[model samples]
Structure formats: structure tokens, C-alpha cells
Target: MNNYLIKTENISKRYPIRKQNARPDTLVGTVIDFLYKPVRNLKELRNLSSAQNSDYELESYIWALNKINLKIKNNEKIGIIGKNGSGKSTLLKILSRITKPTNGTAIIKGRVASLIEVGTGFHQELSGRENVYLNGSILGMSKSEIDQKYDEIIAFSGVAKFIDTPIKRYSSGMRVRLAFSVAAHLEPEILIIDEVLAVGDASFQKKCLGKMDDVAKSGRTVLFVSHNLESIISLCDRVIWIDDGEIKGDGNPLQIVNQYLETINNISESQIDLTSINRDTNSSFQFSKLIMMNQNNIKSSSFNVGDDLIIKLKYSLKDQNLLKSNLQVKISIHNSTQTEVLNLNNEVSGYIHKLINKEGHVVCKIPHIPLGEGIYSINIEAIINSGAADVINNVGSFEIIPGDYFGTGVPNNTKANFYCISEWE
Candidate 1:
């Protein structure tokens, strides 16, 4: 008998790209187009056969997963990390049987429960209580089995106050809470969760992580996909890094997570051109550039522990009327481990900006930087009238070398992200 609970062999999935002019604008064309789909498919097959195997030339289709092979042993907790649009969710959906791979085989030896998206496998028209039983039955649980676990599910979800209300009335957070409660409590042999847990509050996310830990301890398997690296490191023993629909790295959680973080920091530069990075095109006010400098105002990406650091943010406004609104600029500094060490913002500093131009600069100066020796990334966020206008993560990064913050001439602790200056009594 196979000891692996889940196994996939050369699994791949691709979706046909819809052309802009492929569909007709009129009814008669729609009918003819529908009738001729088979012919079009045959032509596409011929084109695919004659075309190069390179993804760039394959305009007709885009591969979401590319020949992924994995073996998940029983009770193993695995975390999948990747950028957005990567194949993490596709692989989970395949293992959950929610979708089929285009060309490959996946063997699941036991019952599997998945929470891929918010309120997935839930009926909006049905009451929360009813959906619980419904989802349990879908997982092959009998009425008696559902009855045995219903209260515990409701209690853990913290949605008992509206258990009898229709799911449409519940907030996204509530639905995720209930969905996770049902999926985790139904006693499925394997639990597959996507980033949907991000919809829940921090406390609830904590509770869910603890429960997943308990589930894994009970000899059940878990396949989790999340962008939260800290949670992945704490909860999972192994991690898999996927990029461009292929496995790039897989091994120890910290090692794989560090590999993933490296890619994010790889984009960092002394002067980051934020306008070129992927961002919301509709944003009214956006950051255009970020320049890091030392106290002398010379551009730099390296700093000593006690050195003064200056960050200059250049932004552009789409509308001049936005000048009337209160603009706030914030920057978050995080360590190599992705733990945030400091947050600097204009609003908190009681500095109100007087915007007189469509484009301008905002400068944040920090004196006596207490950060220990390590690499740090900076994330920028712009808010207008208390509403987020533009938010960009990992906009740039800097390095901090060893320095004496306590005036003792001793090097700061490298393990910690920040150092404190305290006088000995």
C-alpha cells in the first residue's frame, strides 16, 4: 500500500486565452461562433503542433501549472509560497478535486477538504447553520457525524449570533471564519487551505493557525498556501516555492521562505522608480521614486547603526484638486526575516504637508538608527484624506552594518532586528 496521502505525476493545467475580437458583437455572429467552436479548436490544435514550445509564442493558451510532481506523505504540513498568479492555487484546486489537470494524474488516498476562497462550497441563500451541515455532507459526513461536531464548529467560528441568518448577510470575515471552522472540524484526512485566511482578523488567524497545528499533530495532512512568511515558518515544517507555474525551490520552511524573500528584494535599488512597478492604474496619487540617503544627503543604501537616514519620496498627482485633501506618506521597514521593525509616517509626526504642485517630494528623516546588522526592505503607502491612495510593498531595501548604539564599542546583537539604548542602573 502507498504511504503517501497525495501524489501527482506530471500534472499540468492550461487555459485558453480569449482573444479581444474572438466574440461577436451581434446575436447572429454569436450563434455562428458557437457552432464553429469545434472547427476553431481543431485549427488551434494544428497551430499548437506547428508552433514553438516557448510560452511567449503560445498566445492561444497560458499554462497555470506546468508539469508539477509532488508526493505528500501522511500528516505532513506543507506551505506553498509564490507571487500572485503563480500556480499555488491551481495545484491546491487540483488536489482538492475542484478542478482537473489538463495532462497528468493525481492520486488522493483519503478525504480532502479545501478552503480555496472566501465562502467557497457555501450557499449564499442558505443559513449559516444550514451551510455547515451542507458542507459537512458534501465532505461525506453523515447527519450523526455532523451533529457531533456542529456546536464545536459554531463556537470556534464565533458566528453563533447569526447562525440562522442567510450567508449573504454575513461579512467576508464571518464567512471565512465559518468556512474554516467547518473545513477544519469535519475530520477530513487532508486539509487544503489557500490565502483565504487573510480575510479573517489577526486573532482569528492566530486561532486557525493553532488549530492547523493541532490537526497536523493528530496525524492529519495539511497543504497550506499563504503569502504570510512568518506563519509559514512557524506552522509548517516544509515549504515549496513556485514561480511561473513551476517549482523553483522546495525544502526547509525557513530556507524556502528566504529564497522567496530574496526574489522580492532583488528588485530593490538605491533609487526605485515606483511608477514602473505593477500598481493600481486608477490610483489618483502615486509614488514615482524613492531615494535613500545618509545625513550628508548623499544617496546611499548602507547605514551604520547610529547613523542618520533620510528617505525622500517623489510622488505625482493625477488631479490638482487632490491638493485640497490631507496627504499622508508612510514607510515601513522590515528585516530580512520579513518582520517589521519600524514605521515612519508624516501624520504621526504632526507634519502637515502644504501641496502646491502636482508633483512633489516628501522626506522622512530618522536620527540615530537603532537597527542591528541585517538587510531591511522598505514599503511605501500614500494616503489621501485617510484613504489609501497608493500602496507598494518592498519598494526598496537597505543594509545596516554593525555599530555601537550604547556607546560601549561592542557590536549590536546580530540576531535581533533592532537595538535599544538603555543606561545601566
Candidate 2:
């Protein structure tokens, strides 16, 4: 059975710049209205404006959505992605009836339960329990319906202890989790979520995304918008690229993500000139750029299991005491959870303070980076005179990659995130 739960035609919804004005009409005014109304031509008065009523008037008034056309079948998962201010939230809002489109109509074919914004329509004065029932009814759930799912919502939200407390006192993450639980348990045929996943910390975000996976599997259409490319690729089957109120591309998740990345990286590398990285005239101490030495190792998008890597820092000192500076660099590597795996520093061995040679350009090398294959960033600082003055931190971003030294099948569903050449069993 082919079912199209949502579809849109060449649907157009237009509005004028000025609303039509009406005035009090007496019998005498009515007599004048009949005579002057013909001469006035009220239709002409409502013809948008001189330059504002073009077929594409989006230039003047913000066209939240323009000529959007797509047919989504039941249970389809559509992921929306774009840069900030690219109409992603606007599209979701239009579909949710939060706001009407300025120029195009969207035809939705199922009941929608949305968590576009946290604490939407939640009463600040109401307790958590009252708000749950209030929000549930707002989502079309009857009182009995809300009672049936109350326990599950509280459990999934991890707010059973606070379920009776006033939500006005809940933390940001707690509020988000509760709101999401209410929306998820409503069991509407269509679910739309925005970047709420980016609200909480890594672990809570993971739990929310996992819950969304189950919600989608229960035969509900999902339209999710997120900036996390990793999450988007992992969760979405098809991706839509919306830019400047138009659909740029729609295709497989990975391809769309790769295209978006290439576009962003190219712009970052091109438009943001890396040269002239810094300028500080006080005491003559400054660093310009920090980047990976062998970028080709990373550019190919593949890494071997045990490849040596180095992070290079390029800076120039106008004038300084090279020996008195006593340079030091601190580097920390973190996992996906932002948990520190290693905090390698040259302070203990005094290697960092040792690199104060004229300060034109310097490279800090992690002799043998003891970590698995994954994305990592550095926190760099330069301290002078026994941690007295001169400090620069996270100057630039770099990564330590795990090389596929062992020719094994692609790693999946395994905790084998690390690849080290150590003697074992």
C-alpha cells in the first residue's frame, strides 16, 4: 500500500504589505461610499505595492519558505540541514502552524507533535505534573490518554523525582528532557524536531537521539533539523539542504553531508586568510597560527593505525626576552564524551619552556601520541617567567587520527575505538 502522508503542490500563500483598512460607515457615508468606492477601486488599493508585489517579492519581505514541493510517504525520515539563518527553523514553524508561509502553502497529512522550542506553551506558574497534562492536552491527548502514558513520560525524562516539583525550577537540561518526553509520548503521526538535541550535554543528547530513533521506527514521519553532521548522517536516511528559502539539494545523508562539509571548509580555508594571524603590541609576544604539520595525512579522510603526528605553531615576536619567556605548551585529548583521555604537557619534563628560541616559529610534537583513532583538539598556552605573563590557548584546532594499521573490517558496534601497537594476550 502506497501512502503519501504529506504532500505539497505548487501551493501559494501570499500577503500584502498593508492590511485593508475599514472605517465607520454612516448612511451618509454609505451614499458617498457607493459613489467614491467605484472611483477608489479598493482592489487597486490592495495590490501589494509598486515594487513589492513581484512574483518573487521575497527580496523585500522575508519569504520564510518559497515554492517548497515534496511528497513524504508515511514513516519516512527527513533530515533538514543548513547554515544558521537558512530557513531551517522557519520551514518547521510553517509546517507546525506556528506561522503561516508568506508565499507557499504546505499540505500536511497527519497529526503533528512537535518540540520546536523547549517549554513551548508550558505555564511557568504550573507545577511539572500540571504542565504535563496541559502540554499533553495541547498536543491533542485526552485526560485519559495522558494518564495512560504519564509513568512512561516521567521515566524516560529521568524526572520522576522532580515530576511533582514546579518546572520553573528545573535546570535547562531537565526542562528539555521533560518537554521532549511529553512530545514523544503524544504518539502523533508526524514528529518534527529542531536543534533541541544540541541543548544538553553529550550524554543526554545521545539519549534523546536514541529515543527519537524509536519514535521514528513506530511508523511516524520525522523531520529533524540539526547541526551535528555526525548525528545527522547516522540517523537520517535522506537529507534536505535548505538555503536562502529554497531547497538546494536533497539526497542520501552521507553525500549531502560531504557536500556541505566541502562547501564550508573551502570557504573557511579561502575567505579567512590564515596569514597575519595576530597582532599585540604589548611586550612583543604573540603567536599567529596553530595547525597540523602533515595536513595531507588528514586531508585524504583516512588514517593509519599508528602514524606519527605533530601540531605546528607559527608566531612572530616583535621583541622579547627569549630565555626569560620560559615557553610552555599544554595539550589535552578528549573523547566523543568530552572526557579527557590524556593531558600531555611539557611542564613536567620542561620541554615546553625549552622551546623559547627567538619565537619566530615553533612546532610542538607529541613524540608518540598515546591514543586511539578519533578526532581530537589541542589547548595550547604559552607562559613566561614561571607562569607569570604571556599566555595563548586553543590558538588553532588540530586532530590526532587513528591509523588502520591492522587491516580489519570497518569497525561497528564495538568498543574497539583504540588502535595501539601494544603487546597483549
Candidate 3:
């Protein structure tokens, strides 16, 4: 018997970009071209007719996966980490047999299941109950097997009341819940998951993470992908870092995660450039920049505990809306674990009335930074007419370091998360 359940040898996938041409001068020309086009286009026919067949000359291919080689042993839990468009999902798709590799081979020796996206294998018109069996059949399970797991799946999803409801009527969160429940309960030999967990609420996210931890402990092979590095560290024993369609590093989770965070920090600019960001089409206002200013009003990204920190948000409105009456600005602070630590909004603070310009600025002044030593993220929300005009997540991250806030030189205990001012009896 082979010890490795999954093996890839120089696996590569290339997607071809169809030649884009401008629209024809007339509708008749477009219709004629569409209806009378050759089965093989002229360029392809010419290439095939030529004996030399200079196929390498074509530059219309994007390499989504590049020479990905791995020997995943049976029952070894793995976490895949990468930035957006880094080909993490592409690799998972290849492993899940959703797509074929253009080059090389990948051998799998067990049943595979995946939750790559919401409603991935579901029919929107079908009821949730019907989709459960449909998905089970698609996973190659027999009717008897589906019957055995049906109750467990429905119970875990917490949508038992709506089990007979059409999936199209379900919200995005509900769809994710059912999809994840089915994928997790079906008991496949290999389970592949993507970042779809981000769709769930905080409690559900924690529950799903715990279930994944349980699944890994059951001695099954699991390949998980997420941007939450804290969860990755907690769940995975081994981590694989993918970047630009290639594996950059693969080893211990802590070491790889630390290295990846360092790379991200190095690539990050000193300050965020918000003006270049494209606003959503429905946005009534758009954010420009988020600046961190010290007590002296100098811009910076680092601050010490107990230091007064000012967060300045600059934005522009689409029309002349009174800032004091029509606009609401909200700011949320989140730790590296992606947990919200604090939130502030104009509705609660009553400070937007101070602004008097179309180009608006809201400054949040903290008498003393309450957070301990760690990196924190800022999320900005702009609301107009009771609707979200603009929102940004993880826009700018700053670091809080230890300082002599108290008379004693000893640093405050970061584990406890706060420094208490007390009197010695």
C-alpha cells in the first residue's frame, strides 16, 4: 500500500485567453461572423497545417499553477496559505479533480470532497433537502450512505426548519452553512476546503473551526486554506506557502506564517494610499486616506501603549450633503486575530456636526491606546441615507509597542490585555 495518499509531479495548469476583438461596424457583420465562423479559427487552422507548428510562439496563456509538486502523506493535516490570485484555489481545484492540469500528473488514492464556494454543486431551484441528496450523489455516495448522513448534516447546519425550502430563497450565510455541513459530514477520505468560512458569523466560524480540528484528529487527510493565520496556527501541523503560482515555502506552521507576515509587512507601504482605490458604483462617498498622527500631529504607523493616538480619515462626498446631518462615519479596531476590539461611530459620538466641508475629515482621538503589544487593523465605514456609502476592511494596520506608561519601567502584561492604574496600600 502507498503511504502517500496524494502526489503531484510537476503539475501545471494554463488557461487560454480568447482573442478579444472590437465589435464589428454593423450588427449584420457581427451576426454573420458569429454564425459563419469556422470550427477551427484561421489562426488555429494555419498553426495545425504548418509542419513546424510553432505553438510556443503564442503568448495568450496564463499559468495559474506552475510545477506544483507535493507528496501528501495519509492523515497529515495541511494548511495552504497565499494572497489573493496566488493560485491557492487553483491548486485546490486541481486536487479536487474539478479541473485537469495542462501539464504533469496528480495521483489521488481516496474519495475527495470540497467546499470551494457557496452553492458550488447546488441547484438554486431545488429545495435544501433535495440538494443534499443531489450533492451526495455528486460526491459518488450511494443512496444508503446519503440516508445515513442526512440527519447529521441537517442538524449540524442548523437549518432544519428550512430543510424543505428552495435553496434560492436562502441567504448567503445559510447556503454556506448547509454546504459546509454536507461537505464535512459526508465522510470522504480527503477533504479540501477554501476560504469560504469567511462567510459565516463569528460563532459559526468558531464552530466550523472546531469541527475541522475534530476532523483532522479523526485521522483523515485535510487540506485547509484561510487568511486567518491564527486559525491556521491552531489547526494545522504543517503549512504550505504559495505565492505567484509557485510554492515559496513549506514546513512548520509557525515559522512559515511568521515568514509570510514579514513578507507582507515588507511589501506594504509606509502609509495606505486610499485616493487610488476605486469606489463601488453605488457609493455616495469614497474614502481617500487613513492617517495615524502622533500627539505632535505628525503622521506615523507605530505607537506606544498609553500614548495618545489620533486616527484621521479623509473622504469625499459625491454631492453637497451636510456632513452633520446626512453622513455617518464608523471606525472599528481589530486585532491580528481578526476580532473586533473596539468600535466608534458618529451616531454614538455626536462629532460629525463639527465637519463643514465637502471634503470631510473625521479624527478619533484616544487618550491612551488601550491595546497591548500587537498589530491591529482598522476598518472604516461611511454611511449616507441609512445605507453604506463606502466600507473598507483591513485598510491600514499599525503596531503597538510597550512603553513606560506607568512610573515603573517594567512593561505591562500583554497577556492580560490591559494596564490597571492602582494605588499601593
Candidate 4:
């Protein structure tokens, strides 16, 4: 009566690295270098290659996954979140059986469809139409089954025009669209997707999310990894936060996302170094620092209710043409629970409509900080007139202390989001 579809018992994965610079890969170069280099180095290389590949001590290795244990039930929609190199993709690769673990075991009970990369199961020499049948066969689907879904897949992918052409000529976006359409339609018991969907256009990404929603609704297990918190919150029932190749937190999507956001607060003494943040989005400008100021004009991360709060973001343009471009700044404020409490944008505020220079700052001021006594974080984004230029989530955080917002010794409505300045009848 066990419903668990996936189980990993202390699963770990390690990758070896060269003790020094990597040895030359060309056969001729390797032989020449061995003859020219010191004999001691050659002996070391021989010993390194002789040991078992699983042996962790033979050479320096990175533990991509460390003692990870998980049990996922059928039909569960799980979201995975982490900073770059935090092993989110590694875990997905292990679960998909593309990579083996180093120290533990994973037990999977059903068919898996993984869209981890473009052209994952495709052959470059094969036509798109042939690759569809080949990929379906590899997924254990019958030819008849693939034929039944073939038109739908091609239609969804919008690649029907090139179905008979070799996939080597397909662009990355086209390949991903076709791959995702096939994987989602193949009726696999479990589906795994990485952030490669970010390569698609906005409309296609939306289509993929909608298709994933349908997949989850059809009583299949799904493991998704993405930096889009809003999409994760909408599609995932549970979330796991990974840090340094270890599970930092796992539970409710909202709560775990909040926990992950807290750690992204690199701001100190009211200044955040944006270069230290790991962002996945592209941009024509890079952030330099984020500074918060109180009404007294002192930089601080703590403010009292009803006090004026000022946030300033400094950035440098990567392209000089962007200076003349119509750009805007958008900021979102989230409560400690990761629920967005406020969203502000330059277009709405009538503040920064365009850039005046290649390097400068944007300022946002709230005359009265209207928030209950609690901690909150800030998410900042720079957008061109066309699309997003840069996005930095949870870049800064601030705390609000209790204050007499009602202009009396006793404050009004202390439990809600903010106090209401009212005189009761």
C-alpha cells in the first residue's frame, strides 16, 4: 500500500578534478607533454587514473549532492529552488538517471520524462519527425501511441514546418519547444524539468507552464526547478530549498521560498553589493549597490512604523545605448512570509521614466512606513521599455519596530499588516 514513487537514501554525487591543470586531451599533445614534463607528474597521473572512479580520495572532488534523502509520493508537484551551482540541476540529473550518485542509492518506480536540456534525447543526424518516434520508443511508448499524439505534439511545438528536417538545423528555442512538447505528451509517470524553459519566448514559456499544470493535474509526479518564484508558487504544492548541495529547508512552497529569500539578503549596514548576488536573468545594466536610508538621513536597515523610508539603488550601464533607452525600475516588497505586500514601479510612481546617464541611482521614498512590526525584504528589477533588463530578488531586507502611529500612547490595530490612523467614534 506504499504510494511513494521515488526514494533516495543518503544519495550523494561527487566529481573529480585535476590536481593541477587538466592534462591535454589530444593524443599527440598528451604524449609530447609526458615526454617533456617531469616523470613525477606522469606517475601521479597514472595513480590517479588507476583508482576506482567512485573513490573520493584519489583526487580532489566536489560533492554535488551530499547525503540527500527524499521520498516523493505519486502525483506530487515539487519545486526546487537554489542559487547558482547549488546542485538543483545535479539532483534533477541524478533523479533522471543521467548521472549516478557517488555514495547512495535512488529508487524510482515509474517512467520518467526529463526536459533538462535542449535535444536531450535527440540525434543530430535524424530528422525531427524520426527523432519524435525514436524519443518515444526510448521512453517506452509504442509507435501507435506516438502516432496518436504526433500531430498534437508538432502543433504544440509550432515546428510542423521543419518536422522532416534534421534537428541539427533547429535553433535552440525550436528544439526546446519540440522537446518539451514531446515529453509532456508522452504520458510519463514522472516529469522533470530544469530552467532550460527560460530559453523560450514569453508566450511559449507560458504555454509550457500551462501544459505542466495539466500534467500535474493528471495524477503524475512533477519535479520542477526554476528561479521564477511566482510560477513556482502557482504550480508547486511543495518546495525544497538547496544550499551548498544540501537541503536547507523543505516544506510549504510559500514558507520555503521565504526561507530562501532571507538568505539572499546580502545587504549590510544599509548597503547591498549587487555583484555578489547570483542572478539568472540577462540585463543591459548591472547593479552596484542598494542603500536604505531613514528619515534622519542615516543609512539603516531598521525603521519604526510611520517613519519615512528611502531606498536608493545604484547601477552602471553595460551598453551605452541603454542610457538613451526608455528604462524603468520596479520594486516589490514582501513580508516575512514571502507574500508580496507592495509593488512599485517607476511608470506608476512617475519617478524614473528614463535614464539620464550611463551610471547613476534611482530613489524611492515612502513618506510614512505603514507596516506592522516585522521584517520584510525587497525585490528589485530594472526593465527596458521592451522587457526586463535585470532582476535581483531579496536583495535587501529591513525591520519595522512598533511606533505610536495613531498619535496616542496606544496604537491601533497592531495585529494587521499596518496600523490604521483613525479616531474611533
Candidate 5:
């Protein structure tokens, strides 16, 4: 008997690319296109042979996942990390039976509950109370079983007052809370969650993480995907990194996340242009540039312990009117081990900016660098009116050299992430 609870063999998925000018809406055109697809494919295959290149035939489709072979043991906590559109969600969809692979096979030997998206598996017209039973039944749970755990789910969700309310009227956070509560409490052998947890607040996200930890400790399998590297490093025992529809690295969580972060490092110059970086395009504002400097206000990437480190972030607004809204900026510092060492936020620091132009900059100053000797990376995020406008990871990195933080001139040699002043009693 195999101990693997999930196994995928050479799985590949492809979606046909539709031409922008192709008119397939008409029934006749649709029929003709359908009938001609086989001939077109055959011609493409012949062209592939003549051209001696497989890429010639792959122009008509995009491969979301390619030749992925994975075996997940029972009760393993696996974290999947990748850039946007890198096929992390596609792999989870395949494992959840929500989608089929174009080629290869996947075998799952346990019941699965997936919260891939907010409000997924929820009925808009049905009450939250109804959806709990509905999702439970979908997960192969009996009514009696749901009944036994119903109160627990409701209480965990913290939406008891709205349990009888329709799902359509529930906020995104509320829906995620109830959906996660149901999926986590129904006792499925395997649980798969995507980035949907980002919809909740900080407290709720912490609660959900705790619940996931408990579930994993109970000998259940968990496959999680998130952009929060800190959460990934803390919760997952193993991690798999996907890039360009293929597995890039798989193994220890910290190592894999660190490798991924290194690949995304975009700091090639003292001042980097952030306009062309990959990020969410729906936001009304975006970061334009990032500049790092030393205490002398000169561009530098090397700093000593207890030295003042300065950062300047430039941003632009799509609409000038948005300047009236409150803008918040955050900077996260992480060591080479992918562990977050410090987070600096304007809101937390009680700094308010009064902007008068569509383009402006924010400056953050660290009075004394507390980090030990090592290479560290910076991640930046901008929020407008409580909505995340831009988030760029590994925007830059700086080196921290040895310095006497305690002013003892003793040359404190330690591998710790940060150092603090100490005195003999």
C-alpha cells in the first residue's frame, strides 16, 4: 500500500488562445472553427516536424502547468509559492478536482475541502447558514456530522449575527470567514487554500492560521498558497516553487522561499524604476521608484550596525483626485533566510502626509540599524484609503557590516538577525 495521499504524474494543462479578431460568436462560424480545429492542429504538427521545433505548434495555446510530477505524503504541510500567473492556482485546482489536466494523471485518496477563492462553493441567494450545510455536503459530510460541528463553525467565523443572512449581502471578509470556518471544521482529510485569506483583517488571518496549524497537527494534509512569505515560512514544513508553468525548486520551506525571493530581486541600480515591475494593475496608484541612502544622504547599499538607514519611495496617482484619500506606505525587511525582521508602516508610526501633487515621495528613516551583519532585502507596499494599491517584493537589498552597536568596541560577532544594547548588572 502506498503511503502517498496525493500523487500527480506528468500533469499538463493548456488553454487555447483565441485570436482577437476571430469571429466565433455566430453559430456557423463556431461550427466551422470547431470542424477545422483538427485540420489546423494536424497542419501545425506537420509544421512542427518541418521546422524541427516543438514551439511552433504551441503558439495556439498557453500551458498553465507542464509535466508536473508530485507526490504528497499523508499529513504533510506543503506550501506553494510562485509569482502571479505562474500556475500555483492551476495546480491546486487540479488537486481539488475543480479542473482537469490536458495530459497526465492525478490520484487523490482522500476527501478534499478547498477554499480557492472567496465565496467559492457558496450560493449567492442562499443564507450563510444554508451554505454551511451545502458546503459540508459537497465535502461528503453527513447532516449529523455538520450538525455536531455547526456551532463551532459559526462561532469560529464570528459572523453568528449574520448566519441567517444571504451570502450576497455578506462582505468579502464575512464570506471568507464563514467559508474557511466550514472548510476547516468539516473534517476533510485534505484542505487546500489559496490567497483568499488576504481578504480578511489581521486578527482574522491570525485566527485562520491558528486553525490551520491545529488541523495539520491532527494528522491532516494542507496545501497552502500565499504571497506572504512570512506566513509560508512559519506554517509550512515543505515548499514547492513554480516558475513559468514548471517546478523550479521543491524542499525545505525557508530555502525554497529564499531562492524565490532572490530571483525577484530587482535592485540593479542605486535608484530603481518601479513603473515597469509586475504588480496588480487595477490600483489607482503605483510606486515609481525606490532610493536607498546612508546617514549622509548619499546613495549607498552598505550600512553598519547602529547606522542611520534612509529610504525614499516615489509614487504616482492615476487620478489626481485620489490625493484626498489617506495614503499609507509600508516597508518590510527580511534577512537572507527569508525571515521578516522588521516592518515599518506609516500608519503604525503615526506619520501623516499632506500631498499636493499627483506625484509625490515618502521618506522613512531608521534612527539606528539594529540588524546584524548579513544581506537583507526590502519589500514595499502602498495602501490608498485602506486598499492595497501596490506591493513589490525584493525591491532592493543592502548589506549590514560589523559595527559596535553597544559602543564597547568589542566587535560583537553574532549571526543573529538583529542586535541590541546590553549592560552588565
Candidate 6:
């Protein structure tokens, strides 16, 4: 047996395509006029051996993992982090033997168990009780082995009350609890988990991480893939970051991941010009421009919560008695994966009663800012006050990155998005 628990050398997985021309606009022959001129970002594709019709220059093969090389040792707990389509899941699948490599070799040295999707490989048709035995057998456990661990699994899953129920009837969270408990209790030599805790509640997630830690400390190897950087830093000794089908960075979980994050932040900051923000798509009530104003009504984008936020809106009202309008501003603070951490919706004004023909500034003085340090996205909408009625100023999205607040832990979730600055008894 190899001393390293898992090894992969230049491993690549590719999907073969027969070929079809695809673009953003028009049918195969839409008979549309060329003057319409749809806007699109061009994609550069190149070199696929079996691709027919050199007519549309072949693009690069969409290989998910390009020449990945890694060696995992026994009892090592590793985390994988990256953006969407970063091949984090693909790498796990290859190691789980669920998918085969197209270009290189991946070798595993021990009995392996993988939890990718909660309830994956589970038979919906089977009763929860029957599925338990089935999963154990698939894991190469004998009946006696499963029986010995059955109670523990049942207790951990907290589904013992409904053990006889059909698994299909279980809620998404329940399925996750049951599936995680079964896999965790089974005692596999190598545990490959990919964002499984995301389905469970927060407490369950902490518990599951504790379980994984126990397993790793007891000499079982673990490979984890998650978007939660905190978990990656706390639970993993190292990290492997995949990006655009290649290893962008691989090393200490914190340092390398921080570098990747700075790159992401910089890329996002480049797109915040907001110059054409108020342009109308269909030309209803035109929003000329809006600016975040201060206590003195000075326009600005950056501000501390509780500090005055002025909204100077230059708009042309197209209709009269546009009465009962709501000028609502929504702020959503999200993580890199787009999971909403904290959301604040301030209904700054209602019942615009009448429209002043000319443009004017709508002042929104925030008496208390309930947020810590983080980045947030703001959306401004002028609603006609009914369920899904005509939207006036539909312009949404302006960045509201939080400044450092002394003595507060950095806010990064929906709860941490803002702080109340309170004392807990």
C-alpha cells in the first residue's frame, strides 16, 4: 500500500462535445435585421482534436482540472476553496472514484467514503431504515458492523423517531442530518466531504465539524471542499484553491486564501463605475442620477452606519398623482459565495403624494448604523405601492463597503452584516 493516502498526477477530466454553434442572440435563422446589433462578449475557443468544422475556430477544451498534482497523507485534514466552477467538487468526485480522469492517474490507498451532496447515492424509494443497511453494505461493511454502529448513527441523525419513514418524505435538512450521521459513524479510513454541512443547521454544522475533527485526529484522512473560509481556516491545516480549471494557489489555508480573496475584491472594484446606472431600459420615469449624500447632503458612496446617508435623486416624473410611492433602499451584505449574511431594508419614504416636476434630493438620515466591517450592495427602487405594481426608479446596485469599527469582530454573515452594539446578559 502507498504510504500517502491519496495521490494524483497530472489528472484531467474532459467532456467530449459533438459541436453546435451557440451565441447569445437569434435562432438558427431568425430572419432578424442586422441593424438590431445585439451586444455580446466574445469567447475565444481553440484546439480540440475531434472537433469538426474548423469554420468556427475551436475553443479550448473545458477541462475542469488541468494538470493537478497533490499527495495526501494518512490522517491529514485538507480544505479546498474557490469560486463557482472552480472544480472543487470535481476534484472531490475524482478522488471518490465517482468520476474518471481523462489525462492522468489518481490513486487512493484506503477504504474511502465521500459525502458530496446530502442524500447522494441514497435511494428515495427505500425506507430510511432499509437505506441505512444498504449504505453500510455499499461501504463494504458487514451486517454485524452496521448493526454495531446503527444506534450511534440513529442518535446522531436524530431521525430515529422516523426511521421507518420513506427517505423521500424527509425534509432537505433531515436528509442531510441522516446522511451525514451515517457516513460519519461508519468509520471509513478516508473521508471526502464537499460542502455537506451547508445543508444542515448552524449547530449541526459545528457538530459535524467536531465529528470530522475527531475522525481526523484519530488518524482518518479528510479532504473538505467549502466556500466558508472560516471553516477552511479553522478545520484544515492546508488548502488547495482551484480556479478556471487550474491550481491558482495551494499552501497554508490562510495566506494563500487571503491572496486569492484580494484578487477577487480588486476584480469586483473595477466594475463599480456606476456611470450609466440611472439609464432607462424601456423609458418609463427616467432616473437621471442618484448619490449617497451626507448629513450636510454632500454626495458620497462610502459612509459609517448611523452616519447620515443622503440620496440625491435627479429624476423626471412622467405622470401625475403618482401617489403612494415608496422609495425603499435595500442593502445586502454577502460572502464571496453570494450567501446573504445580513440584510437591511430601510423604507426611507412612503406616500410621495405628488411629484415635483423638477429633480430634488431625498435625504435619508440613518440615526443608527447596525453594521460592522464588510462590503454591502445597495438597491434603490421607487415602487407604486401595491403588490408588484409599476416600478419607477428600478435602478439597483451600488457598493456600500463597511469601514473598520473598533472592538467589533468583522461582520461577514447575514447576522454579522450589521451590529446592534449591545451587551448580552
Estimated TM-score for each candidate: 0.58, 0.54, 0.59, 0.58, 0.57, 0.61
lDDT winner: 5
Q: CA shift at 314, candidate 1, in angstroms?
A: 20
1-425: candidate 3 lDDT, tens digit per residue: 77999999998876543332322446796687677567537664554334122245543445667899999998988999976557899999999988777678999999888878755679999999999888877766788988998999899999999999999999878887888777777578898988877887888888888888899999899999888888889989899999768999899999999988875543223357787765333334677878887778877778888777798888776544434435678888776655578898877876653434778777788867777877777778776645556767667878778876675877655665666577888
What residue runs in model 1 are displaced by over 4 Å at the alpha carbon? 19-58, 169-172, 268-425
Each model's lDDT comes to 0.80, 0.62, 0.76, 0.79, 0.80, 0.63
> Residues 77-186, candidate 1, lDDT per residue (tens digit)?
99999866678999998898877787789999988877776555689999999999988777667889989999999999999999999999999889889988887785
- For residues 219-241, write the lDDT of model 5, one tens digit per residue: 98999998888888998999999
Residue-level lDDT of model 6, residues 1-425, one tens digit each, is 55898889998765432222211233522334233324211221223333222233333335667789999888788988876656788889899888777678988888988887666568988888898888767765789988999999899999898899999999878888888887888678888888877778988888988988888888888899988788888888888888766888888988978987765543132113333543222233445555555566555555664455454445554543332234343434444443555444455334242334534334344544555444433434443333221122212222444543334556434435555656679
Superior candidate under lDDT, 1 versus 3: 1
- Model 3: how large is the Cα RMSD against the reference? 11.5
Q: Give the higher-lDDT candidate: 2 or 3.
A: 3
On the 0 to 100 scale, the lDDT of residue 32 in model 6 is 42
Residue 81: error of model 1 in Å?
0.7
lDDT sort, best first = 5, 1, 4, 3, 6, 2
lDDT (C-alpha) at residue 22 in model 6: 17
Clashes of each: 0, 7, 0, 0, 0, 13
In the range 168-235, model 4's lDDT, one tens digit per residue, is: 99997888788777776868899888976677889998998898899899999999998888889999
For candidate 6, report its TM-score. 0.61
Deviation (Å) of 167 in candidate 2:
2.1
Comparison by TM-score, 1 against 2, better one: 1
RMSD (CA, Å), each prediction: 11.0, 17.4, 11.5, 13.6, 12.6, 10.9
lDDT of 5: 0.80
lDDT of model 4 at position 400: 81
